[model samples]
Target: MTLHVHSMLIDGNEVAASDGAVVEVDDPSTGQVIATTPRATPADLERALAASARGWETWRETTAWERSAVLRRAAVLLDERTEEIAVVLTREQGKPLAEARAELQSTVEQLDWFADEARRVYGRTVASRHPDQRMQVLRQPIGPVAAFTPWNFPVLLASRKVAPALAAGCSVILKPAEEAPGAALAMATALTEAGLPPGVLNVVTGDPAQISERLIASPVIRKVSLTGSVPVGKHVLQLAAQGVKNVSMELGGHAPVLVFGDADPELAGRMCAAGKFRNAGQVCIAATRFYVQEAIEEAFVASFTAATRALSVGSGLVDGTDVGPLASSRGLARTVELVEDAVTQGATVQTGGHRLDDGPGYFYAPTVLSGVPETATIMQTEPFGPLAPIATFSTFEDALRRANGTPYGLAGYVFSEDLTTATRAAEQLEVGIVGVNSVAVSGAQVPFGGIKESGIGAENGTEGLDAYLYSKSVVTGLRRLR
Candidate 1:
């Protein structure tokens, strides 16, 4: 298959960098360059900013119904091209084809959800204490937004930012990850074709540092939204502080799964294993730490190991492949290092470990480590790969304490039949999302975000739309009837 030639989208047109420089796009499944995307320069960013300013002026004045119609059409367009874009996504991002299709479906759902939400940007009338006085609270778009998305789920994360901002009548300048630009560019194309005004949604691909610093520092940008690593999020936050821009971050997560003694150990293990290895465990909300009660540790570990070893790993383009290569060599190296560190710290390899040498791709065995010490490096760090660390807990309090031990707290899970046990675990787990007896914690209609260092604000649901809006209080005094 011929890969799509990616380019920067400015003023509703595809163009190369002003200096004619480009970045190579690699297919992780083969470790080969399959395509190239325009590397945006400072001048290109300036043009994008100016275009966004003009776009915001037009977009913010459009009626909410008009915005809703455009977004809904965009969703339909995306749905029609799901299979085509899924191929591009799988080639660049190294996820299984089925998973890539699912991501596209989720992206479509986000646009549709935001489309309906556009018309629901309601205002409220408040009763006035004095006669002949009226008060109203109105929600308005927060102006142009600078959005940054990661490569793990490029199109989905970009849609998470772009769909909501546009639905709120705000134009956006998006800087998608350089590794996987095709899917995001495809989404931009669909939006433009769906009657979105020129410059309303611009996609740029280049050096993340240069793009983020220039865009966030610009006076034209009023809001910043990002889905990336914690360090990158911190850097963006620091830059946004200079302009005092409204910021929303969905950063890194080292999620924990708690398996209580009363829970079905085999069922919990299988579920946790599935959640942990999805997308090769590149997910920010992936189950990284498995904390099982001591009474059921043996059974849980046994089942988890069997389920993990049963997965079929290969190229994303190949059918019947359950897992695919790491998105980059750096990811492969990091996964290897995490497992080695765990073993050195007294952890035992319960299943697959070490890199797979069956091909040239960046593939690692889906690994599981048991008896991991609390001091292991993997215990503290967000291992964004296919590495699972299992540790035993003696009691509920111990499990909660161990689960909340890390600074990151994006998502947590609990599997127990007892209502009190499940309720208490959900309440005490230091996370933005909790899944009891399940790992499906996110949806278009549900609020998705974290507290502590995980993130600053929420996304998805009404909260996601509100992130792009600001409230205005209007008070009007009427002439008294004589």
Candidate 2:
């Protein structure tokens, strides 16, 4: 498939913005403009929302079987076109092709899973105190939803919200990140080609603030979902609160990986490094912080540093590259700023520190910062980069305290073969998800999100369905006694 230089998918139309303004989508690997997407205007968003609102009545009335059929067909279509979608994703967002493929495949499975779940959605009947009255609890489509998804995991995160919303019989207006919209557009195309009703799934690409405000303020939109930074999430929540809109947020995370002395030091180092550096360390649940027991700190650091140094940083299109450039120029600048602040604050650069000048693209080498003070900016903030900050601790309680110190608690990890110690730490970790001896905390089958500043609500699994639907209690007269 040839990449379109610029385009936007709105209300099932592959059209350009009315203003005729296009934003360049550059490939971070080559610093070349791969494609251009429309810079959506306020008018564009209103049009999309209006179309969605008008389409919702028919969508909500569609039988569960009909919705499921369309969704399942979409899943099959996604599977067939995974390669093309993955390539577009890699070019737009600087993620490895393999990882992009994995994400795309996962998105297809997510839709299938939700489609199956739609058929199994069950309501229960309860006996009332009086024979004249019986009660039942049921779930129904909420209405048209506004899904605001981040650039990272473009295909997967959008599916995480859209799959459940469509399965639950709600139409959606998706506002994917401006920097990465191709994969989302591709998904929308697949759904439309699979016979989904026009306007049932709308895609809008534009400025975040203008689009978000219009979507949240619209009375026709009853639910809102987002996956992004903490400040953004809070702002969305505040706006949604105005209308009491049902909302689900899967926001930022400063995940910590605790390496206990009891674990294999070498294995722990390898896993932590791989997980942290995946997508060039641009993940919400990326293991940015490494907390190791004092006894094994030296061994873990040596192994981790070696692993980071060996990582191949280059184009995501390259076959052997394990790391790639940050998705956007702004993203690269933020990564540089955070690392520089830590270094200026007396942190030691253990392995990598600066950007590579050999390429036109924005490429930062996998960096590891040691002796980083807890008071440092990087330590306090979510370092959504390839920088790993390792701190040594003498006791479990101290590790627990340090892990819970940050305002953000999205995910936590511990590497310990000892069941007791791992269980204790997992229980005490002040986060929504925890991983033991592994950094793979994300999957379509599991509910993923965070606590505290990480954001509110959850995505994936049956829990995500609640975000797209509302529960109602029905009361009936069991007998005509009157």
Candidate 3:
């Protein structure tokens, strides 16, 4: 299929880079260049920042009802164009068509949720100690925001930042991953068509380093939000610190799944396998380390390996393909390296261990490793791929200790029939979000983020809206006994 070149969305207009340079986007499913997007130059970034400043002025003054109306309309437009954008997402990010569509649907839901949230950003009238004093607290937009999103779940991640910022009346300049620029552009188009004023939302793609440094350094950007690797998040945080700008980050995760003996091993194995290999296991919250209770470890490993082997790995566009290729060659190499490292450190590959050489794409078979030692590299590192490593723990304390050993505190999961066991695991797991007998921990209504090295602050729910807002306290002297 022929794909069209995408242009950068700046100041409500689709334009090429000032230097006319472009970056080619590769289809990970086929290892082919499917399309190109304009590479944003330094000058283009300036334009976006200037436009954002102007947009912020107008947007912040807009009534909450008006902002809500625009977001609701944008959500409708996004819903209408779901299939078209989902195809683009599948092509660029190499996820199954169904998963791509689901991501877009989530994006639509986020917009809808934020639309209603816009009107609900309530302030409070404070009780005053003196009869003559009147006090109130108000929340105001924190000016323009600089948002950076990763290629995996590009559209959904972008919306997670943009929707909340917009709902809070903050202008946004979104720097979407160049690997999947079309989805963000499509979102920008929908918002613009839904009457978002020029400059309120801008989409730029190109050199990530250049764009981030310039945007974060600029005076126009009041907040910075990012969904990326830990290293990248740290870099962005450092840059934001120079200006003391408000920042939020959702970084990498090495989530652990604790399967207690009381739980149904077969059910837990099947569910964890499905969660582990979704999007070829590119998920930040993908279940990586499995600490199954010693009594059920053998059964869990057997079931998990069977489920992992059953996944159909192929091009995302093909029918019945459950797992797609890694998003890029680098991702494939990293996955390979992690597997090799684990094997060298005394892990046994129970199912898959090598790349799928059937085609030219960056594909790897869904792998399950048994007897993975804590000393193995995979135990400490976040293997953001379709690889599951299982180990056994004799006691609940041992499970908790091993699970909490990683520097990452993004997410953790537990499967136990006993409420006491599940609740204890939930309370003890050193992560921001915990899932009991399930891996579904993210949604528009909940706060999604991590602790420790995973990230700072939160996304979604009312907390997400608060990220883009600043509070102001007002006090007035009232006439006594008037």
Candidate 4:
């Protein structure tokens, strides 16, 4: 099913920009202009915010069960069209079809999880010191929210924030990435078909900086959420600070994977390869850095090199392709520069580093390099592509220090059979999330966020719902004063 790209969803209507400007959206797999979305202006922003603000009153009064029902129906619709949505995602985002399908499934699960949690949102009651004098704490919706989503994992990331906010009785104005607007439009269409109240969940698509800043600065939006780079997150934070608005950010990551001497060499190699190549390494939590114990460094490198070399790079539309193109021309150029600079800095190329010249897509080979020094630019920056840089460490402390050296503290992984060593490493790693003997560890029931420069706030499980809500204290007094 071909879906028309929508530019705006204001007052429960799918409408185009009044100015009629458009943005070209290409399929990264083939570099074909697949669609165009309305490029909204400040006027469209105002219409959405006003609509959502007015809708908040009714949405906040709506029953949690009603909201859950809408979400549940939306989930069903997503499942029914999973393949259609996944194709659009793979074509636009350059993720392998299998991974795209998995993301679609995950998005469905998130909607269901948040839908259930919406009903379970309960307040607390406090006992009073005197008879007839009681204290109570209640959770209330924060009003209209401005949600900004990134191009990577477009559907899943947006669902992560939008689903929870709507579930918690809040009206949302979504500004999805212009590169992949189909998935968001599909989601909005589902929500509308599921009988969601008009204006409760309006969507607006356009340039992020121009649209997000204006929305954040407006008093009509009481909260803001984003999933993007550290620099963008900070900018959004600064803008949100003007209103002291609540914000949840899931930003950049330079995730490290430590392979200790005790780790099973084959398992470590396989897991690392899978994590690094997933989404062609566009994932925020992809295992980009590998710090192996000196004794087992050769063995780990050999296995990892073989695994990465065996990957099949091609268009995501094809079956059996392990890796796909970068999301756009800019992503391909950035990855090329990082690899070229790293090699110039004396890093040894292990297996793959060349762009695939066979196709129109912006494809790059899964790359593995060794002997990358601490000062290499790629060492600190997230390649966000199919490049894995490996380094050796003589001691556990050295590996820990190097892993924690970056400003990002999002996610880390350690492969060790020794429980004591794993525990120590997990404790010392400053990241908010750590993977022991594994590479992938994100779920709907866990609080997911980063520390330090990674960004602020958390999402998922109970905390995600709490992010879109506020707490109020109530006190009761007797006829006589205390």
lDDT of 3 by residue, 1-482 (tens): 68578998888899999999999999998888999998999999999999999999999999999999999999999999999998999999999999999999999999999999999898899999998999999999999999999998999999999999999999999999999988988999999999999999998899999999999999999999999999999999999999999899999999999999999999999999889999999999999999999999888998998988889988888889999999999999999998998899889999999998967799999999888899888899999999998999999999999999989999999999999999999999999999999988899999999999999999999999999999999999987774
- TM-score-based ranking, best first? 1, 3, 4, 2
lDDT of 4 by residue, 1-482 (tens): 46355557888898998899888888888888888888989999889888898889989999999999999999999899999988888877878899989998989989999989999888899998888798999998888999999898899998998899999999999988999888877888888898888889888887777898889999999999999999999899999998899888888999988899999887799789988899899999888899999898888989999999899988898999899889999999999999899999999999888887867788888999999887888998988999999989989889999999999999999999999999999999989899998887899999889999997888888988999889899998878756
Who is ahead in TM-score, 2 or 4? 4
Q: What is the RMSD of candidate 4?
A: 1.8
TM-scores of the candidates in the order shown: 0.99, 0.97, 0.99, 0.97
Residue-wise C-alpha lDDT for candidate 2, range 1-482, written one tens digit per residue:
45466566666788788898877777888888778888888888888888898778888888899889998999999999989888899999989999999999889989898988788677889988987888999989999999999988888889998999999989899988888889988888889998888788888887889889999999989999999998999899999999999888888888878889999998898888888899988889988888889899888888899999999988898999899898877777888898888889888888989987766788998998887888878888887878899888889999999999988889999999999999999999999999988888877778887888887878887887766777799998765755
Task: Write the residue-wise lDDT of candidate 1 on 46-104 in tens digits.
Answer: 99999999999999999999999999999999999999999999999999999999999
- Predicted structure 1: lDDT: 0.94
Worst 10 residues of 3 by lDDT: 1-10
Q: lDDT of all predictions, in order shown?
A: 0.94, 0.87, 0.94, 0.89
Better of 2 and 4 by lDDT: 4
Judge candidate 1 at residue 61 and give its lDDT: 96
Give the lDDT of residue 37 in candidate 1: 93
RMSD of each: 1.0, 1.7, 1.0, 1.8
User: Which portions of model 4 show Cα errors greater than 4 Å?
Assistant: 1-5, 480-482
The per-residue C-alpha lDDT of model 1 at residue 6 equals 78
Residue 86 in model 2: shift from native, Å?
1.6
